[model samples]
Target chain A: MLNVTEMLEEIKNSPYREIEICAPHTGRVNFAAIQQGSKVEGPHGLWKEKPGTLLCTLDRERNPKPIAAVEKGELCLLHSELEGCFVEAGTRLAVIRHLLTRDEVQAAILKKALHLFTAPERAKYYFVPEIDKKVRTSGSQSVTVKDGMELFIMSRMKREVPLVYTGPAGLIYAVYFTHTSNVDAEQPLIGVCPPDQLAAIQEVIMRVQTEWTEQG
Target chain B: MGKSNKESNVAPAGGLIDVSSHKVLVANRGEIAMRIMRACVKLGVAFTAIFTKEDTASGHVRLAKELGGEKNLYRVSSYHDANELMAVADDAECTAVHPGYGFFAEDFRFARRVSKRDRKLIFIGPSWKIIRELGDKINTKRLARSLNVPTVPGSDRPIYDEMEAERIARTVFDFQVQQGIKRPLVLVKASAGGGGMGIEEVYDIDNFRSVYRRIRNYAMRQFKDEGVLIEQRITDFNHLEVQIVSDRSGKNPVHFGTRNCSIQSTGLQKRLEVAPGFSPDEINYSFDARKVLDDIVHYSLTMARKVGYDNVGTWEWIVTHDGSPFLMEVNTRIQVENGVSARIASVKGEGGVDLLAEQIRIGLGEPLGYNQQDIAFNGVGIEYRLIAEDPDNRFTPWAGLIERFGWQEKPWLTMHTHVPTDVPYEIPTEFDPNLALAIVWGENIEQAKDRGRLFLDSLELKGCKKTGGELKSNVAFLRQKTAGILQF
Candidate 1:
């Protein structure tokens, strides 16, 4: 069993504790050129109303990752505005919406409110071990990398992320984890992990599964 | 009255029809009803479209109004309500009634009721006596035996208990031993129904009681009869059937063509039907299939002639693993998949009319099979009967007005039927949950199956949650298992 009073006390104490998640694929603006201070609405440029910056990451597998500035904000595009921006898997990103005020979120209510809380401001940060110091300007550098690799990278930086996308064509597994009791009480939980990603997602699942199995 | 209202008021009523005129009331729904209604129109006779609340919106009713005018199209409570149907026919002054292969199509009581109410309501099919007689497995088996058609060893009557099923299985084993059969399996089959009703294949003797009891309960609920017939299970068998047409003048039996319904789940209801025969490879695998069909047809015709079979019917024959044929059953009226026969018939220069249309045409003394020998496959006609059900709930029938019916056209196929707007259909709990059939006519079995697969993908029927999509997947699985190529 969980002590509602202790869980509530912990939630109160940590109400404003900040958690940062870096979304690596959110800020690469492709095909962009800077005219000192001139305003231009090219494919790679940020919207005229709001100016933003981009960060890039390079992977060893010949695929470059771009993190756009828009990834730091809430998903605010109309349904039809976002057309074809794609994010590959394993790109580190964090969602940091302010879920609840210090007075609102209690452990007793948290059990029934997974979807009710607001998400945090999601910010993306990219990492490339080799290109930690590399920076690119329009039209110069990386011409030999590919025909228009810089341009391609710039154009994608500001594009809105598609909420839904197709996964790579291969096997997929759906894992479910059920929490059987409150977190403070160290109660049982039920966890499920797909066979392929058993090792990766298994730790979280086993704890939950053990709780649920024991509770039953 | 305005022209439209005038037209609506002027229901197609021929001049004062005599009491004995050969006016026909079609007792069915959908394309079959429309098809039979056409026959009445062609004969220059009055046609009455007896419909349920659901069938009011159907194409058949509209066609009746077109042919016989507005007055000819009437409504009924239910097709199976024999007394109400008879009263409607009498009120319409119809001389005959055609049961179009569903609802009351195979029902003996409906036919008998109509006949009793109006002696001249000439039920345009096999007699009620024949429907009842051939309906019973025991009697049909005996008839098959008399015609020299081989039958699985079993009793001629419905079994009452587990002991009877075991006893029959033992007898079948002994009979198989005498015939040199090894490890023979027995099937407990219902005596008085078709379409794989209450047929359970039992391998172990211990499983016999449960299988028997299950089928017994199912048969009792379905046919109002719990009697069962036991037969030797013919494994690795190819199902073949002959379409025989006969009438009052004499038994005019002819083999339209043979179709192999072998692509099905063993010991269960038939799922897929491919007509005009399967590939040569299938035939080669079962060497005696063709000869077996010939024998079965010969014997079926003989039995029909002896028993005074009228109009059109089908004789079901199954070929054993050792290339021998046995009489499985007989259907006394139109079949759900008779579109295959019509498709082949049309390519040979005959009119593209289905079995119900053929029955009407034949009954009216129309010439049939003018070029029977020349008739060949136009292509393969594939059909999937849609059953309304929740997919997650093991596909139980969900009854209601279909909310959506959708289609996407392709160049290779043609859809022969259209939904009528007047019929308000609900899934009746009393009957099989199948709502409608989706048919695809293609150039070959492969092409047809391919079109069937695509057609299922594009089809959308609103109102009821349907299993056509699921069945489409099942059909693909079956085709793959049977090594049938469905190139799309």
Candidate 2:
């Protein structure tokens, strides 16, 4: 069996990442201007427009409306049945990978604190460290964490339960919550980073947050 | 100072009501919210509306702003969150909350919360205690039995386990044998379910176990209640209901005639018409159509009074081919078909006493203002629900921007829709697909049918155009049903 420290280290070192393009509204896909494995710039490429440029059209009557790109990245995994297909709003249209160096990617992840656990609403949360903080950070510059491990607790009504971590294993970059206290749902309670997999982890976190905001 | 006679008649349970200064928060959406807003306008009361993020640009939000001003319109995340809705009501300083239909309209917890809130907001529908009593089918049937109201033959208690289900099925089979029913049918239903959901039909004894499990699973998923009830399924039956309005005093409950909604597809009501003797085929089924209707009205009022029901409600019943009416269930809120019934009632010279307005009046501890004898059942009205679905594509829901919505002007027809013209409207991906309803009233059923056909043909919703044509409405189905050429 792998020790808790080793498991956390393994999670922090692993790297796997992808970005998805989602449909802005519900309609029939008129056409797809770009194919998979196409390198594109922010807003413009095969579709030929700037950021917020209409990549394709969705027909809802005799009039066809535009579906625009929100960011600039290399296109990948274009849906096979894209043309003449009905797609609901918020459905993932394609995946994209941002072309960046290792140092630039790490800077991007740290700048936004994209690795933090943002509270969904205002509530009291209790932190429960899985491993001794001293042992996990003795030789490292950050705290390590693993997926499926409980690190915090939230009390709702009369029940007290642990708050689960759904993201991949990562290192705790910053600790914003020093005690069990009430915080706004929009506030980020902690900052985390996968030491060697910042790009992959950031991609997952961004996609999840995007979907969450859209649903709200 | 001397006390007035009207003041003496006020019920002690409700205390003295001051409707003149009351502010109501409408906790619903779509056409129902508009209906309630009209009532608030007529009564000279402040109205409030709560909407979600999806409905920020909806017509209901605009209507609420127009009626109650900007402060009265609130945008919440979810309609099902009772605490948030109550908080909005409190912030708005509403005197009462009117749950138009669906959502929390029949939720006993919401009613209790409103009544128990710090500010003590009044609920426009029935009291929470009464809602709890009638919401449970088992208790409703028991109360109906005690009041001598006819109910369908079924198990007296809820079936708990597999053994209990089998036992009830055996008993139903024996009852069918006694009634000389060769092709016996058993209906398994959730004790706390409504809206034609969580129901299953069992044809054979061997299939009882699987069907029961399936229905129980569905009930648990949908209503969070696994308790099931068994009832006999009437193969040939006519769907009918009586519209009744009562006050908190419970002494006077008046029925406003009967409505026939026998035409349905996949358990959803497609078309509804007021009065029974309109169609020759329908009249042929019953020995005396007038007497049957009278019986329905009488029984419905009787049960309403027994339950001490308040506000507007519909006592639904299923009339078998033998002309025996069995109490199916009770809808504690205003239904979609009420538009047609209200139109017919207005034509009867009732001075257009809107049902929603009457419900608010009753909530204010006022009487129904009129008695059963004063109601005049005149003219025929038919309503067709135009759903945003494809009939050719197995009725798949289609959502998109409505570019062109065209409907000709007609005095006889009244369209109840939230879709705005002049500007493009986007039908969201979530919620029910019911886009609008078209209600047409005439001197008689024949005239109403003719006008309905014409109105439907003129109406158009140019959403995402399919390969063959535009998105299909229920126009074809409504036309065929009106002509009596479509089979139910």
* Predicted complexes: DockQ each: 0.01, 0.03
C-alpha lDDT of candidate 2 relative to the true structure: 0.68
DockQ of 1: 0.01
Error of 1 at B454 (Å): 3.9
Candidate 1 lDDT, A4-48, residue by residue in tens: 445545555554322232322222223222222222221233444
First chain TM-score, candidate 2: 0.40
Per-candidate chain B TM: 0.78, 0.90
- At residue B278, candidate 1 shows an lDDT of 43
Native-contact recovery for every candidate? Answer: 0.00, 0.00
Question: Relative to the unseen true structure, what is the C-alpha lDDT of residue B37 in candidate 1, on a scale of 0 to 100?
Answer: 72
Per-model chain A TM: 0.21, 0.40
